[model samples]
Target: MQRANEALQTQVTELTHGKTDHQGSDRHTTTTVVNFQPFSQEIAEEEIPEHVKTLALDSYSGSSDPKEHLVYFNTRMVIAGVNDAVKCKLLPSTFRKSAMTWFTTLPPGSNADFTEFSTRFLSHFSTSRSVQATITAFLTVIQRENESIKSYMTRFNELSVYLEDSVPSVCVAAFKNGLREGRLNGNLKRHQETSMVEIRARARSYILEEEDNRQKQKRDGTTSLKGATHLGPASKFNQAKTNRPGPYQARLSTRPSAPKPLKVVNAAEASKETGTAGMNATCGGTMLNAPVSDILKEATCL
Candidate 1:
């Protein structure tokens, strides 16, 4: 038994190496024969061998075809190794025909159909290469039926619910928010630049006006000192005329000996007389003498 097992192991290794070599050669060839297989067939659950059935039931409960589901599950296992989260939830008994029913009803280019398909099957699978290979196989079948690539892509988009439902929602929200913020920032930047430009233009205009006024004043000989000197000349001419007495004023000054200079009653004398008249008129008594400043200071203090 041990020798037979060893022989089987060696044969398996050799077969694996041969398959790899064939695949490499096929990659370089222009035309290579490829196999086409359909995934629609159902395997009888009762006919499944006990050990394999136990394993399949544990992992492929939601799939319609246990055999095909096993292939997809194994491929995912190989691709994701032990790090995949969704793999832990798979069970053989999870298989339900309704899970894949949406695929049959989907029109050629409907996103809803593809979305349903992806949600039912593709999302459960972990291996990108396997998923791609499966998609390519489906595309080959579709092309064989003379469908356009556009129709295929439309179906593909419809089926790829993972990208459409989750990734784009999160990514597009963040992207749109970032774009909105950037636009607002750009608008603020433009407004600031415009305000600065207006301020600089206004400042330039004010400086130019000031410079023009200075230049005109200089050209007209009306600069500060020149204007002051011109005003002084007019004042000097008026002073000379005022210093000479008028012809009629000389005759009137000689008469009446100037009447003792008429003891001019200034603002202080007038204020004192008015205050005394008010006190006499109000109290009917002549209030005794007090200096106007003293009276004003006493009244203010009171």
Candidate 2:
């Protein structure tokens, strides 16, 4: 009887152990269920149109400007005529690396709509947003010394692209202020209310005139240099000839001439003789309108 009771107790214990094992397995299954997602039920359920399969988007890895990526995404979506629901679905496909990791970490059902999703994305990546340029930035761009007006214009125009709301008059003002002081600046100052179109036209004319003047000066300088170079050889030859000794120089060099003997004569007698000789020559018609002192001066000069 005791053995039967022991057997019955063992059977009861086995059945109890099996029930506990089954319950433990059921609990484990319940805990394994996952529910993490950033999108709402509506967005998740939204059907992606057939046209979306043909489209491809470049992925963002959180390294570049997030705002630019959004702008590009929005532009394409607008062109494709996709709705907000479709935008939400398509946007995630463009994310990779850190961007995808960021998306995955967002709380479930946090994004109710495309607008909210975009807003959150922008807010989270605010540091990665491209700084919107202002008119102040344009004003600060001064034309460097010796910088060409054409080059300055190109730089100014390139900067203007960032300032979408920049007025033509304001641009003209900024451009005028930034110019190196010269005829262009002076001309711009005279026209207080000039349009950018007129400013550009005036600049073009000035650029042409400046180029022409530069070319003329260059040509003049080249001609002057050539003239100097052409005359250089002749001048050098003349100088060398002047300094060079004659072929008979060695033969001509001989003993110095003896000093003349000193002669003493009366100044009055000499003057009297010179005056008489000059009067005779003047009267003979050989010397015309000649005075004694003039004749003396001419003899002295000779």
Candidate 3:
């Protein structure tokens, strides 16, 4: 009887232990299976915010990658007609975030930002026709943002000053004019002055050439001096013998008489004599009167 009681106790203890272990395993499996779907749903909802949804809805919405999304957001900020000053303040911070995000996602040592994205973005305004339209649209959007034209101009000038290196000619001109008329400070004007100095330096050669030509014509007695040296060397020798004067004496003797007034030659007579249209022919059909080099330089400076 004692042995049988001991066996029964042992059986009860083993069964109890087996039941406890089975219950523990079932609880662990239930926890994992039951909580996973709800947790995953929560995570998915948390990852996508309302702003991101709205951005995705927009025509120019950015990428799914956070870094790319940041760049896209900033680019859309400009396209969406955000104020320039605001954009200037926002862009650098967003750009840093974008770069960081991009770097983190990329493989170590990958070259993601090596491409000049800004250059590609600005290239859309490389021509006059497109530039004018873009500027007009941007200005219109700025005006609608409760900002004055002057304020808009100032901001635009500030935004584009660094970008001037890549901006088109018409766009730069438009920006310059806007700054000149506006709430913008004199920064563009100062740049203009520097550009003008460079232009004048470049055109110096042309100006000097024009001045030299004028001086030469003035000293050469205009058209009248061309045929004055008519005597051949032999005739000059005969005249020297007849006059009994040395070469220097002939020059001195000729200097005493009052100089005769030169005949004012007409255009036709001058062209006929020269077998060309005078200076006009040599100048490639352009009028020599207009200061073309100076005008071109001034236009470029502006």
Candidate 4:
């Protein structure tokens, strides 16, 4: 029994070390491949993430065959921490019965493997390579008049992916050249070509700076408009008037009120004259002297 056990252990070790089937031309070598970190991210839960559904749905293009967009949608799955098993299982639930019937018709034994399924899917639908188209798009990327840096960068990155053999420096230069003429673009032009990392850092800085400027402008505009409604040409006219005083008002405000002359009074003389003459006639005949203000008031009244 011990000798039999020893023989079994020897056979096991030989098999583990890949025993040669024959010598020379007929010698066979078995390859043992190690699968290290198969999953991109740790997927602790059994159920797939809900974002996977959204991603698949969003990426699934109706115009193209299912095979044409599988790669595109698969990228999102990889990023979402899904393994091949989970991806295979969860992907079908996203499709309708009519659409899924195509997958049902796949060759026998092909349904078990993800790689096989992908190959079959792509083979069923002809997807021509887009290297030339991608190149054209990359070369023609340009920043629009008021396009955001993020949007421009996103477009640039997407296009750059097509230039598979392009150097990082060349890609960065292409991106810089596509930017609109402004502070950020000028900085990129004057900047020394270092690396894609540094270029992206500068781009991020410019984006933040632009965002701050936009927010400030929005706040200022809101504050000014909050004071009154924007009345087109009339608003401009009102604003100009409010900003500067009217010519007539300014002229009148500077000039002082005109003074009126006081009436000449002779009370003592009138009294002496009245003492000799008949008192009633003298007093009644003389006119009473009035103050300038009172005279002006009387004139105004008249």
For candidate 1, give the lDDT of residue 185: 30
- Compared with the true structure, what per-residue lDDT tens digits does model 2 show for residues 72-99? 9999999999899889989989998888
lDDT of 1 at 4: 100
lDDT of 3 by residue, 229-296 (tens): 22223344444555686789879877877778666554456667768743442233323343577446
- Cα distance off (Å), candidate 4, residue 299: 28
RMSD of 3: 30.1
Q: lDDT per model, in order?
A: 0.40, 0.70, 0.43, 0.58
lDDT of 1 by residue, 1-302 (tens): 99999999999999999999999888756232222111212211113333333353333333333336656665654554432223323322354454334233433333322124344455444332234443443333321122222333344443333333333433222222222222223443454332322323333443455456555654544435311222223344555765777888988886665344344444445557667444322232212354556556556544
The digit string of per-residue lDDT tens for model 4 on 210-289 reads 66665554544432321122212334554565677689989989988999876554545565765744433233334346
Which regions in candidate 4 have their CA more than 4 angstroms from the true location? 1-68, 71-131, 162-166, 222-302
> Which 10 residues in a row give candidate 1 its minimum summed lDDT?
36-45
Which numbered prediction scores highest in lDDT against the true structure? 2
Candidate 2 runs further than 4 Å off: 1-132, 164-166, 217-302
Query: Candidate 1: which stretches are off by over 4 Å?
Result: 1-50, 56-72, 75-93, 103-120, 123-161, 164-174, 178-302
Estimate the overall C-alpha local distance difference test score of candidate 1.
0.40
Alpha-carbon error at 251 in model 2, in Å?
A: 35
Please give the RMSD to the true structure for each candidate, in Å: 29.5, 18.4, 30.1, 15.9
